[model samples]
Target chain A: MEQSYLIDLKQVVKRFPMGKGSFTALKGLDLQFEAGEFAGLIGPSGSGKTTLLNIIGTLDLPSEGGGTVLGHPIEHLKASEAALLRKERIGFIFQSYNLLQVHTVFENVEFPLLLLGMPSEERRKKVMEALDWVGLADRHRSRPSQLSGGECQRVAIARAMVKQPSLVLADEPTANLDAANSHHVLKTMQQLNEAFQTTFLFATHDEKVISYLKRKIYLMDGQLVKDERV
Target chain B: MKLAWLLAWRNLMGAGLRTFLNVLVLSFAFVMILWMEGVMVGWDQQSKEDMRAWSIGAGQYWHPAYDAYDVLSLTDAHAVIPKETVRSGLVPVLATQASLFPQGRMMPVRLNGIPSQQSLLKLPTAALDTTMDAIPALMGTSMASKVHLNRGDRVLVQWRDRNGTFDAMEIELVDVFQTTVPAVDAGQVWIDLSVLQELMMLPNEATWLTMGEATVDSERMAPFVWKPFSELTRDIDAMIETKSSGQAVFYVVLLLLAMLAIFDTQVLSIFRRQKEIGTYVALGYTRREVVWLFTVEGSMHAVLAALLAAVYGIPLLWWQSVVGFTIPMDTEGFGMAIAPTLYPVYSLGLVVTTFVLVLITTGLVSYWPSRRIAKMNPTDALRGKIQ
Candidate 1:
């Protein structure tokens, strides 16, 4: 069966003002990702890969042209509506595993559900289920600092998936991990993707990350160089 | 909303030293404001009471017939003091200066001739016995000690009459009074009206009739021929106005300083948390949510500071009341009794005012920075970019 497009971008552009000049970050790019697709965005440093991911994540607006996420026009969405879309339909995974340092693993995972005003019992059930899926059930009570690099990323994954968002946008997920931890994190993400069939969009320059995706989009100097399906 | 609060609280806890410093500075400012307000309120209350005691009632009296420059009446006491004075509910007293010869040393004394009945009622309880009969004339302890007059000593008094003729009489010093109010204890001599009338050659009259309480129609006293004390001490009105204005200026300066401190603390807090605030926005929290989060945090700090201030303020106020603050004795001279100790009185209105002032300052200080947080681009915020 053919899949439906979860995110679609056409002629998207982003620019930043710099010292009386403008730096064009993304220039007239077109992209599309289907629902339940495990896609990778691969590029060199400063090649606008992260900028594209941010635009897709509804964290930034295109300077010109438009895009759609979950069938909603990104350009026309107000800030509040964009935030609501992000809250209800999307999850984010940062390169640094941006877990609130003061909260334990369980609490971190419980955050989004709490924002949704879930009851304590419902929140606990969802958070533990996410942690169980990420294989961090035993470490739920530990703080981020107390965890290893791999454990912290697992906690981040649990936090991302606890709300069961339709799409997960991860920025350099294994950038800070060692070889063994990176392998473990990639394996866990793959397991989650196969089990839940949630769409995963990863932005990275690392070959190890690029090799893990079923589909890959390549960019060079703010322009798309290749789009590949595996 | 709960998530934001949880995140804010977590961030606050994570940044322990920063949060502690902010709380300390905030609480200190709160305490200082409350303490200053307490002192001002206490001083105002003390001033009002002192005014009442020094001037007798809220009103005063003098002979309407005599001009400010004219010699005061000593013999024509009836012109000011009427027979139906008590019926009018006015407490009448005769005030004049007399030459005192005590143990052969001469000194000037202020003789306050109060009616025998009214004097007993108005005098502080410490000065008189339970009986309605007259106690021997009350002399200030300082004056009594200076002249070496014991309780039974006789002092010769001389005074001028309304016609500028002089007369002399003798009175026994029976009671000595002392008060924390310094000026009153230095030169006052309280005497009976009958003795003062005979001594000044106005045998059946009183010189100045002072009312203990305000008359129902003080305007009636205007036509009956007596000037109120309010007219005699017109300078006090100016003094009170000057003091009030000075206090206002001081409060304004203090408030400005407090606002600056609050503003500085909030700006610094936002600057330090730029990354965190950005992260929150990037994590699906709207700008309004972010602004509201910071606002709630600021309000929490303000409320905590106010609570701490109240805890510290009440005891400090009580201490001030009990011990009192002293001013230089030699600065103001004898006839004007300045209180040696001043106490601050606490009022609910003052407390509420201080709390509101602090809350408003905290809220305003948080506004601009929270707006900045709201306006920030999530991409920049995520990259820890601050402008």
Candidate 2:
């Protein structure tokens, strides 16, 4: 019943079916996040960083755990309830920059607002604001296919930020970009984080992404190894 | 649903040629189903019109003993012509079996006798009122051609009377008229009703009376049963029904082919665009919403096809209705009533029905493949993995 943290987990475990046996993606772990925190779940491959991030994002549920995200019990949320939680309170940014290829940058960024049934004029204004935050306001008419890797990531960030959700879950958001593009994307996220005071949770092992985080939680073989604050 | 439609429309338009090709094939089905159905309806209408004009005017009253399919029944099918029926302007017809020797070749024919000056029917009965020495007889062009006789030719006609007495006479082919109704033409001859009555020794008698302007609804007159218009045109109606069933098969196949293309596209879209589907879910769409999105996307092909079909079909179908379709071969051999050129008739019901059918069928076809999305994992789909 402790609903103080934005996301709270205790004794959480996640398992996947693998040919007559089970693969434990995450071991018994205790974690918590507060409002407006900039943090990262840092680990190498097969170390359960993405699994924990997914659990917090409400995209997946822990097999045996008591978890709450934004005052909603993660394990008890129905499909629509989970979807609504994601829709109104959480945003996601993937490493691949999964922008709709057929849509212009403006349309892509405006999608979440459209889902919320926002009025078109107001939706357009908010979309322009999000694009300005990412410094891609002038490229609103260009499609994802027409944008560079860094620009597409920026558009994804704007899309995640357009609705101004309480939390944003980003998984390896800069993995596909070069060093310059990676630093550029990171700077935009850092600025957006400070300007909006929105909580940012990332699942990554990249040192560049790790360097920008104010708090880092390290995982090793599905167990929490360390929690550090800069 | 509106948002889904808008997104589907944009997606289809963005797809460009793939969407166009599917629409093109589906549009072909739309036009063909409508066009062919229209022609069938027109054929039915034309046949009924021709029959009504040339033969059975409004309806007919047949003698109790008459069986059109039984040739021997002609011997006893005659009854005295009803005075009240005559007063109602109905045309009485008397038919008897006869043998005609044209150029010494014998052939059996039905000698149908109608009033020479009757205006109730479109047959050239007035041509029977001739001043020639021999009896004036009129036959259809097919019969005339079959007998190899022209106008002014004389042929020997022999027949039997009520008393079983044989008699012979020479009749002149006064008129060889052209008519589309096979019932009124083909192996039949028309002459003065009075002359046939006198020859058969059964005066004031007729086999049947074709109702004219004033339709009679009398069952009181025994030995004469009233046949309504629908009853009289039963064979033609049955033939049209059979043709309609055949047409249903044709268009169903046409629809299936178009649906196959849509089904293939939907299957391919679900597999090839896994990332998009996952993105949709990650963007806060329910799996069911994603399924509906794909279904709407597929169904939109029919909408686009209908519009595209309308772009070309309206003018083409209109032109066809006006100019009519001409059969490439002779229709005379077709036993029932048919025209050399057929004009199609389109109704609002037909067009709307075809449109709805294509829409529903395409939706079902699209939905069948889209159900797979509900089972897909968002994490896996985001990774573009086929699950």
Candidate 3:
């Protein structure tokens, strides 16, 4: 039963302190994600899309009820355990293309594998293969600052998929890109998800991203409003 | 640990000028500390060497009544030389109190009597044996200049005989000697031992006997204390130790400036690289790992600085040792054993100790600020928040 779900959340509530009292970010939300699903948490700002993405990524703990991610309890996990879970099983792509500015494209893509303690020869082979997938194999030596918006996103996707993780969490992955680059990054992620059958979870309000997701979950004011198969 | 070292090295290299400036500052500290300490060590060795040559040859045998500091003790300090010491090694020297009138001004003086034919010590006392009008004597350059006496000049000397009667005579200054050691040259006059004994009415008696090594049998020499070279120079050693302790403050200040540069760099790196730190965490690095990465980066500054110091410091320190450092003050009457120019002597231990001190200091300075990373919230850090 646990193998069927990559992420399983039940009665999850998240709150953050605002001045004196606490503000509820997620209230009694239940969500289940099956393996190899291309899903998006679609909501506007203040609807907790980023919050949910962070929770799923084990970057935050639920304040009220808890859930499991990759068969490990998410709420109040030790820092080392959470790091290991994220390191071995989860991948993240941020809106600003959080590629290390100083590292070349190859080094950035190879970072996660390095943390996973992969040896040099195999790590090089896997990194090159991931670069080949993102179509940035020729730009491996180029730094992030030298790349365009679309190229930087391609580098980020290459970095995320280099480890071939079970789930990749992208937070507004196309926010900084124009329409052409947005669709290009989205279509690349779509192809990577289908080819590797790796689960992809996106937090975005962008319509272009919505059109690509196989399933969309809509949240409004700390509550899930709709779930639909696109 | 190897991965941390590798990434830390890469990060430092990528930092470019900021890293270079920190390393340069730390390197300066290493050079300054080592140089200063080398000078002190050189000074200590030179003082001991000069003492051994000019004044206390290996050791000395003092008469029970003799105390070099108290002039009254010198009057009664003389005793007949021991028979056992006369054959192989010991050379007797008669020390007595006297007064001189040079340029019509009264000056207190020590009249040291040395055998004209002895080679057991470094004093140029052979110059005292001369066929001159008055008793041939030698005065240090300091005493010569103060008394306005030249090599051939005669000065009036007053002394006491065996009957406690006062006597006056003119003594020829056969030679004026130059030496770095103040003990031999300050307010002192040297005369032939036979002549001094004849004048003082104390024949065949000496204040102390100098020998080549510590071979004097203390049991046979019952009333006399045989002072070895180690005991003879204990005061000088203590003085140098006290001076070194006072100088440790300067070393601390120098190291503090270097450490401040490193500490500032580490704190700034933590602030500026928070995003990179978060990225590291998100990539599955424990917060502890990130701390280690930053710590290694900071401590590596000392390593780089040590290399940099070797590039420039080696030649400079070697040249300084060869050329020696000249003091600005006139050393003519500076009453202690010191040379006009001091040559630095650096032992292997001094160099290694200094390096370890800087390395440990840098590691601590780096770790103090980097510890904050372990407490940083991963989610906030990922957003590049200031927390």
Candidate 4:
């Protein structure tokens, strides 16, 4: 039978070594996400939300237990296989707007497509479309250092969305943005989610971001406490 | 690899001043190395040519008793000239030790006797054919300067005859000539072969015969041992090789300075760009790929430097080769043949070898610092946290 969910995790436990002992970040966590879902993992600091997000992104693997993401067992994937999974199927956005500071907005958005070995003409078209989606088409020539914080984040969004990956993993994507820029970034994400049916998973505690998620899963002290659908 | 090159080039260009400084230092090294090596080659070639023209003709045949290194052998070095060898255009040279009293100052000098009409050597021997009241002789400018003797000046000369009898006579300095070869000029005097043979009572005897022709059969030269050109000029070749070795140290120091500048920049770039490295990982590059990217970036500096060197170095080096570099101080006293002005000769091999060596070295130093990136955690790197 075909899998119904794009991500399926069971009893995923994550432990990090600290001093002579270990600190457990996630305890017996089970989660699932279907295609095209717009969801958030809501929590306070040290509640293991980002750690869970990293696992789902395949940036990390669970210390114990295993999960399947997009049909591949995440725990057993080699480093190269994980990189290919991210390259073709996943996109990441960070809060501080981790754009290559030296590259222009157009070049930054064009990076993922270049990695895909897309022809130059096709890459230019896709990069332009992605920049237009974030309302930064006119600022494509400006470097990240030359742009405002919101503009920098939008360029990052353009970079992540350039390849139109099936899943987008965002960690505190609005933590550095003001109220107005946060709403603008969220609306951009909301529209992209509904338009392409791409799954959006965010790890955040921001109220503005929480209100925008269709489903919110709350965690406390490394354990899930509540799940709600608005 | 192409993507790495494109990104590396852009990154270096974005660096602006820092990149310019590195390329400038490396290009300076490139030009200097080629210039110095070219000079060494020029010196080697000049020395050989000067030696050939000024003293060692095609080759020589030494009397069996002759040993240039052993002064005592000169007494018995002379032998009867072979008729066949003399007929084959070989110029007989008779050498004997003599004492000269010039301006009341006594000095010992090597007296060389050559056929006045011979054209096998570049010496002004024809001047020795004069019928002056005193026996005519020639002195190198160096020897004349040291003895303070001028043209037409008579100096008292003393020598031993074939019968071991000491004889003295006044010889007029017919001419004072200039030559670059110190071996033939320093502490030496030249006179007509017939005059010296009659004076020494050793007619038809010669210490050595210089060949005017390009090739001669050593077997026919019998009692006189033939010395080929290679054997005759071995000392000059050795001295030049030693000089070339000494020059290698200077080139090494220059290359090291450029390498250090490049290495320092690469280390700083890697240290400061951890976040950028992590971003590359998130954008689908493996840690190995990122390492390769940085390595290529560093190697590109060498490529840029080579191009930059060609821009300015070509015209400058070509001008030097054409105009030549003149030594400010006197070198005739250095006891070797050295022209006043040295024209550098750059071979295609020299330029290519230097460029390839510097490129590989730059790649190594760049790769050395880049290896640290392979061990970094993507999560930590993405957060700009040093690990």
**Superposed model 3: Cα runs more than 4 Å off:** A1-4
Model 3: per-residue Cα lDDT over B258-335, one tens digit each:
899989999998888887887888888999999988899999999999999999999999999999999889887667
Which model is ahead, 1 or 3, in terms of lDDT?
3
Find the 10 residues in a row with the least total lDDT in model 4 chain B. Answer: B212-221
Model 1 CA RMSD to the hidden true structure, in angstroms: 4.9
Model 4 stretches astray by more than 4 angstroms = A1-4, B61-65, B78-90, B200-205, B209-213, B224-228
Top of the candidates by lDDT: 2
The deviation in Å at residue B247 for candidate 4 is: 2.8
Q: Which lDDT value does model 3 have at B138?
A: 88
**How well does candidate 4 reproduce the true complex, by DockQ?**
0.64
- Lowest lDDT block of 10, candidate 4 chain A: A2-11
Which is better, 1 or 2, measured by DockQ?
A: 2
Better of 3 and 4 by lDDT: 4
Candidate 3, residues A1-230: lDDT per residue as tens digits? 53557888989898999999988989889999988899999998989888888888988888878878988888869888999998998999988888888778998999898888899999999999999998999999998889999999989999989999999999999999999999989999999999999999999999999999999999987789999986
Error of 3 at B189 (Å): 2.0
What fraction of the true interface contacts does model 4 reproduce?
Answer: 0.44
Model 4: per-residue lDDT, tens digit, B78-114?
A: 9888876756888899999989998887898888889
The residue-by-residue lDDT of candidate 4 on A1-230, one tens digit each, is 95668999889999999999999999989888999999999999999999898888887889998789888898898878888888888999998888887788999999999888899999999999999999999999998889988888889888888899999989999999999999999999999999999999999999999999998999998898998877
Across all candidates, the chain A TM-score values are 0.97, 0.98, 0.97, 0.98
